[model samples]
Target: MTVHEVHFPVRFEASVEDQPGPLWKARFDRYWPAYRTWFLRTATVGRPTYLDCRRAMRQHMPELVPVWESLVDLAGGGDVEARFLSLWCPPPYIGGCTQAVWLDPTGHEEPALLRNYDYAPALLEGNWVATRWLGPRVVAMSDCLWGALDGINEAGLACSLSFGGRAVSGQGFGVPLVLRYVLEMATTTREAVRMLERLPVSTTYSITMLDRQADWATVFVAPDRKAEVVRQAVVTNHQRDIEWPEHAKATRSVERQSWLAARVAQPGSAQDIAMALMSPPMVQDAYQRGYGTLYTASYRPRSGAIGLLWPGSEPWMQSVADFKEGQRDIVFPPPPAAVGST
Candidate 1:
């Protein structure tokens, strides 16, 4: 295991802006080639599903239209809407993550979120970014795909997502986009739950949200557009109960869930919990294979602060009071081998 100290700079933009400017353009351009390859291979084949998701976005959250349009203009024009829609309806991809919310826990000074995002090792290199969308003033960490994986808003609403442990794909939006929508629009756990319920998702996902009021909910969403809310404090990849047999057999969802439940049952401070996530049962170590724990993020909604840590620097903390102040790059450990090399 190795670690590198890098800064994560956040960019702010308003919806009224015609374009995302040159920096954003460069980032988008760098990601476009790979994105286009993925889009053509997966989403383009499901045209109707893509259009349906597009319609759903238009109907359910029209306010986001301007942002999509801005992305299109930034792309220098070419069916960017379709490409954006493709992100909302991505091809099936397997991911592992563990997330939990601590509400009013003893010795826990404030409400906090503990999360570890495990994915392809290559992604840890450059695709991940943190941004503060000025239009709605949301501070979030996202990928080259332009959808938020986790974030908090100025209103003290924070949320994160975990794979729902189901492989079924349907006609709906991606979880990341839905997360972005919630952070951008909702101010409370109830409002975030409502958005999760109303939105049509193309895959299975569990979204855990926390607010400054100490309210939290883990909403389990399916490909069929069915959503059920579980008011539990911990969540892994699967729902409370697994419905997909193959998915259940394949993922460590149940094991991770049990591990989290037991850890939270004992009294611990926020730091203790966050540190626990950096170890076994939480921190996965298959970096060369692309299923390793890339980063762990702790969001403190009450104080509007974020702390980030990776494999080697668990005891040390990198605190960001405001994500909009300056630019920083979070230097990452070199990939174990060339990505996908056998």
Candidate 2:
């Protein structure tokens, strides 16, 4: 038996709000049905208890508790809604992404964080969001309804997450919420690294942080080990070694990492580095496998600007400093079968 080939159209939206309100409500209403179905996929495994979820929030990320309550309120405040929003040891998820820090030797381009989010398009939240949920403004792509996939904060810190290419799962929060927490709480790469060192992720993930000070670090966090922080720039699906060979092969993680590493070692502008992500070896077009390059996100942490690019489409630009609200209908024309995947 085999799976049928399929592809999807993604609707990328830029939404702004000071707090949870109409935009959040409409989004919840539009996607909660699908989200509910996905959330209950682990019914047989027994999802975490609501009390346990709240306790985890209180114990680890207490600052986000109020925001959780607000999101739950907007979600109708059911037991499942509360638990799912906590992102505390919920259902397992894995995604493909390529991220790197751009430091130009020519002194022409400001430091930037370049990312390509490769995933099943239908599952992509598609919300390029800007919010003031926790005081400082955050501009990011939304995941888990409210959590960030990759984003920059008003404090000039930018963060992105990629699956650590391991199957291990344990008691900890999802990486999406942790990314959100970092954007809200940290002001620099050093501060973000320290925070990730102590935060427990439910599974393995590689988190890359960049700041306006031209500082950068990549933290490899997992459920089964202590966090490892390195000053390396490029990150893909794995950590120091390839732990999952099948996933490594499927995502072409090693090849993509090597390609980007070689690319980063050269002299070029930040835009040149970001544009590389759209080409072969960096772009993954295996939509049939549930992971394909959906969008390229270039974050200029020095100025808090986001450039959302497609292969042939005009880049949709936004910023944490002054976010514009609009929507873009996105079409993911398949890229050529490349030498590697992101």
Candidate 3:
């Protein structure tokens, strides 16, 4: 198998108020075209009104109101609907993540989370930013959307996500924003589960949450606004059973779930688990455009520490207590050339 390396440059910014004005501007300019295209295409029919989304956020996650308002201001008060749609509209189903939670049954070691975020190859070349929200002191990764794909909060809560192997879409918020809400508001896996249960997600998604107390839950949320909590340590794209037949047939969820289950059943140290995330079945190859393992992140909630790894670089570790604001560039293996392209 060929290995394709992709480089991601990390940028750290203080609270929403402190982020560079130009930063938001550049992001908006680059992604607005794509965002508009996606919105027009997916939300043409059965789309939720702006008022509906606002009401849902206020009713379920009032804490994010101020955050959203701040984002609106940063967006220069233009295309307000577009901004809200980014958070409310259902994005195209992007899958291919393998996440697991390892709890020390003896309580002698800290619990850890391992995950590989896979998506379209175009996203790999996009400007992905990792911001540390000063208001809540949360560190998270996001793209053009102002939602978090994964993050760890100062409260020692860590959260990550995978596309639920389903084709259903509904009248709820995007899962990425929901993940951002959990990291900012919840302090334990139990609390996170509560928020997941309450908030309505527009699509099916699997969220794996771990906290400092070694408590964890993998919740499968459907578009119908129902959520099921799994106590097991491993989760892939699918729920307990494949609810979406077409999606199941298209993805390798069965194989990946089995691979993760077999690996977690064995007794291993934290390093062993982390290593497993960087290898096959977990770390995916570039099978299609924008569909490969972008990066693997390991979070230790007990210490509020996070380590990031890619195809080549050594693991980089940072903790909330000792985080320094700066930027670092990561270079990844280039994608394979197209069949007939020069």
Candidate 4:
């Protein structure tokens, strides 16, 4: 097992308003079918959100209709697909996501989502453009994953989704695909929570989200539709403070959490917090190797200041994104590239 950590320095012009949500829909139009099929075979969920999302795609993006339908035959679960479609709709209430909006501790929620991309293609095709073959305009950018590990978004909405080490395998469930959905479809913590509730998820795992604004929270969903939250503020690997079933025999999430807590407190400066979050240690567990233990981020909304600390690799990675005037710079070697058009 290998763990890789990457830092992103996002630059946003004051002229740019809120990031577009339809951009995500466009991405779904191209990639949703493969993902949906994967989910039907692998994930578990309580509501029909996943099915609804697929329908939305079929109507809005006709090109993907066949691909989506073909997945049913490929997975040989057309009945499941039909069942999901029958119950899908907009949810009434979404849960709370753990998010910390650092308004400069003064007032500045203007910082945009800093883009960071990391992944293991063998586990998940790293070159996002590969998704484009599914259709024209299909691009997977600014995402992170180790095989099927976890990632953060351009909006600083980061998540560490893990397969519960416990070996309680259920029906066909696709986790990676659903994770992609969370990042692509949801913009806020509440929306992310709804995405989890409405969709079907395979396997028992935990998903954590942290927007650039600093708000952060974790949700643990089981294959049985029963969901719990790790409401103590932040989440690491294993889980704590929440009463949820463990997916495996041995989980280090608690140890990782303690390791991080000892390093940084809640009410600290962005720099100190980033440093504490950047520190890394070793873990013999296969699931965590190369995975950065401490992932620190600070957002000064007043000045649109965003910082990231990823010390998992030999040369610790650090960077800053100043959204005030649309400027992003990296302090580490092998600087990050400028945002490009797909």
Candidate 5:
């Protein structure tokens, strides 16, 4: 049997609060340094101006404009900080993920979303957040400050994302903030799909959405192509087909997609699905290559509960209604060099 080459240790924390106040400001203070680094990584190539960001937000995501302004003030109102909060037309980044909508054959277990978020630990924000920013409560894994990686809203809408395998870039909002907007506004899987259609996303990505009404769909969106909402139970890194062979190969997208398709077709407990995500194909161990399975997330929309799972540990459970602020110290097995490339 083969495993990893080294250990990547990280801290995972959770925060539940209503509307930005003290906690939100404190979060900005803590993560601003790292967020600034990520926002400026490609600064040599001329980025957008603060006015450009605000104008784009007001034009496309008008409802979030107020929230954006408030967050900017909370972040100390620096020009760079305001621009990054807008998340408009940011540089493209890569990540690998395997996500599926799992349903019980006998209609016993909760209709759920299972996913493995694969990315470099150093780049991971690693915070589980529950907040009531707009109206309904939203519980999500935070990415770029206020952006959501995967989340469930109080209205019984849950969704997760996988980086669509492509190297395209364009004039649009970063996918993370787009996802945050969806969770904040949309209430069902269908509505989430509609929201994706009108939004100008900066890059390619696959979004799997599930609602408590037993409705689900995987919407494939990209800056360079038309967005398609497919009746897919599973999605891994690509769209209808692998347009980027190198990325698809490195992430084992095809293999993971096939494995998950079969895995979800069978009847199993929620634990079974989560375990599958934590296993091979669905899981990646290529930390040295800037990709790895950081966590396996199980979101039950009906209950608004999220099971954050990691190997060698019990799941840390959270919900939109019953969120308990906590933290986990995780030490992942050291990864091999370019584990995804093998």
Candidate 6:
């Protein structure tokens, strides 16, 4: 899909939080700055529940109160509006796997990074901690979707988010914080899935988690406080293995997923199949979407490695980064013993 040109100035810091379990929630509390209102409005469908997520964030991260207050003030009377509203509604049939390829139409350009800094070297004084500057290297959109978007934590657990087609009309789910929370709190995929399943959030979304040993599951949450887990396997953009009114809706993204899945080689790593989904623009839905979409991401739990490919670009941009594509890969490592086990 041709995405709205967005320049994301992001930073990834990997460290244990001050408190043991609050890592995910707290990070959402702390670094809620870079989150753009446009992403929240359009992407999240502008639910008041999202605001509740922000409120929880403020409660947990009192230190960022000033900043949060400023953001709220910027919004004036109510929730901040999103500048960009991109595609959502890829078919639910586009199943996910322990090791699968990822795709991000956005975050594919040269990073117009204003500035970046990390505090991992200085032992974390609190629950928040970050890794060293892993890369000063230039990367493509993988950073938004591959790097910071989803990846494994130092403890070897991997996490990723896929769309969930459910109606969400509340004010309390913070998407970025939720992503960050998984990496921060859970050391294994199972733990991460549990955290998401139990979280009393009102956001309409789903998450896939894999542990160091390849155990994987999906956590789906709705505005009704109804959360369920698809044990052993999961997928998204719609409910997996079940039909929901929202999931059944036909959209171009759904068509593309079906088209890609048919051509993908099965009984192989999902990551490989995902990469296959990024077929050349000639065969892709790029023409359907004037903006064009070609980037995809895949994760190999066995190797604790991630493979990224950009078929739309010249020479086919490919590299391996940590689960989080926020940083560039200097050297791709060997795959791990199991698919999802870090």
What TM-score, computed on C-alpha atoms, does each candidate reach? Answer: 0.83, 0.95, 0.84, 0.46, 0.94, 0.50
Of candidates 3 and 2, the better by lDDT? 2
Which candidate, 2 or 3, has the higher TM-score?
A: 2
Residue range 1-342, candidate 6, lDDT tens digits: 222222112222333222223443344344334334324534545333434544555554334344334434434324432111111111111212111232222523211100001111111111113322121221212121112335455555556555455545343334434555556556676677666765544346566665556566667765466678775232435655334453334323344445444443234344334444443311222122222222234444444444434333221222223323133221111122211222
Model 6 ranges with Cα > 4 A deviation:
1-55, 58-148, 232-234, 240-265, 269-271, 280-294, 312-342
Error of 6 at 124 (Å): 30
Each candidate structure's count of clashing pairs: 7, 0, 8, 36, 2, 58
Highest TM-score: give the candidate number: 2
Q: What C-alpha lDDT, on a 0 to 100 scale, does residue 15 get in candidate 2?
A: 85
lDDT, each prediction: 0.68, 0.87, 0.70, 0.38, 0.86, 0.37
Write the candidate numbers in order of decreasing lDDT.
2, 5, 3, 1, 4, 6
Q: After superposition, how far is residue 107 of candidate 1 from its true place, in Å?
A: 6.5
Candidate 4 deviant stretches above 4 angstroms = 1-157, 212-215, 240-251, 270-274, 277-342
RMSD (Cα, Å) of model 1: 5.8
Worst 10 residues of 6 by lDDT: 110-119
Q: Could you tell me which residue pairs clash in candidate 1? A: 6-329, 6-330, 6-331, 7-328, 7-329, 7-330, 9-328
The local distance difference test score of model 1 is 0.68
Looking at candidate 3, the ten consecutive residues that score lowest on lDDT are 333-342
Better of 3 and 4 by lDDT: 3
Specify the highest-lDDT model's number: 2
Worst 10 residues of 2 by lDDT: 333-342
Least accurate 10 contiguous residues by lDDT in model 4: 90-99
Clash pairs for candidate 3: 5-332, 5-333, 6-332, 6-333, 7-332, 119-290, 120-290, 121-290
